[model samples]
Target: MDFLTLDYFIKLFNIILIDLVLAGDNAIVIALAARNLPKEHQKKAIIWGTVGAVIIRIAATLAVVWLLQLPFLLLIGGVLLVWIAYKLLVDEKEHNIEAKPQLWPAIRTIIIADAVMGFDNVIAVAGAAHGSFDLVIIGLIVSVPIMVWGSTLFIRLVEKFPVIITIGAGVLAYTAGSMLTGDPFVKGWFDENPVMKWAFIAIVVIGVILAGYLKKLSKNFISINEQGQLTIPDSIKNEAQIEANDSFEAKVDDQGRIVLVKVAKSEG
Candidate 1:
């Protein structure tokens, strides 16, 4: 259990890596929240907002560490993480523009958004830190600047290559599944059935991917009928190469807003 060992360093590296990858949304939040302020106040807002986020993360990670010590809490957290991943994949409204032209409001929005959206990051980082508060703090310290300064670049990359978002979500799912299997409540069962760990991870990863795929499928065009029911637009069905008799499944986003209307795959 030497803190200076290579294994410990690897864990620390993992914490940093997770922070960098999964923190893109927070960066976007900071940027958008502060973008509406006066030009002179923009930089100040970003700096102070990042500082605020880091402080919040520290408190959140500390709380998660304590909560994780209890039985079954990790399992609950894992479920929440999985849901977060699913939402990340399906929800398309990540970009929120602000035109308030005010300073304090922008800064306030930044902090509030960070607080609301930070659970996924805090839990993922806490899991990667492996219960080391020092590791968590150091990891956040090292990665927050990259997110704050490099946010525009990261956002461009994510937009150009949407796979990055999927990858980030997958990472969250993997962390969540790992936490579930490693939770004290189920740790003994997993120890006795060693294969269960890999099985759990596989299920989580595949489930996430499949859910995302289905969400994508829902992007097909549909018409809202007089009764408020969804129906495939005849022209769109022909364009989509879908058969007339094909069924569709509507997918709702995290906020219960329907995003897409997709034709159900026919059973052979």
Candidate 2:
């Protein structure tokens, strides 16, 4: 496919979308792994970890065409993708952020977790790429920074508006179902009966909702920083909210949670 064509652009978009959805947990893992390192070392860990992850995903994507050629492999991957989507919707354990301040260990942890957890993500990206590895490479290159750096913002958004997470889960479920129907073993079956494709999608969507409800019964939504390792300082500097000329006072608890934030009176 030509890089400048509309079909290629659409595939690139899908690849990027799949990566972002799959990257939320990865961002958290990176943060937790690097939290204990010195500030400079933390940066290094994120850089190297991201580099390693990108390389690993690229290599995996490159092998997708060959791997998918094996009988039943696509079906097995689709089943795994459904399970991963379910876990993404429901898993809520707070990762232990306290660790030795060694940088290499942190980087290793990030890489290992990323490699293990990225199976479904890699599958989704390969499906999106549609055998065009160039699209996969371009998409990952654009998305790695967002996954590495924008995790905090994405976490906060999910907390504030949980529907985002639900939508994300739905997207993953759709991908799983799509892959299942497209698997070569069953592709002929679905191709003959177009309605069966939508039926599989409905089944996957129902599965996601049911699994989420059951998991919710045993889980509680807590602040991401409930362990006190993550902190948010209350400071605002914006054109409409608070200018650089303005001052503010922030009240932080012992756990570093911001309890109050208010504009301070100017002291002449």
Q: Please name the candidate that would achieve the greatest lDDT relative to the true structure.
A: 1
Residue 69 Cα positional deviation in candidate 2, in Å, after optimal superposition: 3.1
Q: Pick by TM-score: which candidate is best?
A: 1
TM-score, every prediction: 0.74, 0.70
Q: Which stretches of candidate 1 lie over 4 Å from their true place?
A: 1-10, 95-105, 221-268
Predicted candidate 1 versus true structure: per-residue lDDT over 119-168, tens digit per residue: 77888887766677888877788778877777678878988988877777
Please list the Cα RMSD from the true structure of every candidate, rounded to 1 decimal place: 9.8, 11.5
Q: Which ten-residue region of model 1 has the weakest summed lDDT?
A: 92-101
Q: Per-residue CA lDDT of candidate 2, range 65-135, in tens? A: 56865768777767877887787777754565545489988888888878887777888777656566678
Regions of model 2 farther than 4 Å from truth: 2-10, 97-100, 214-268
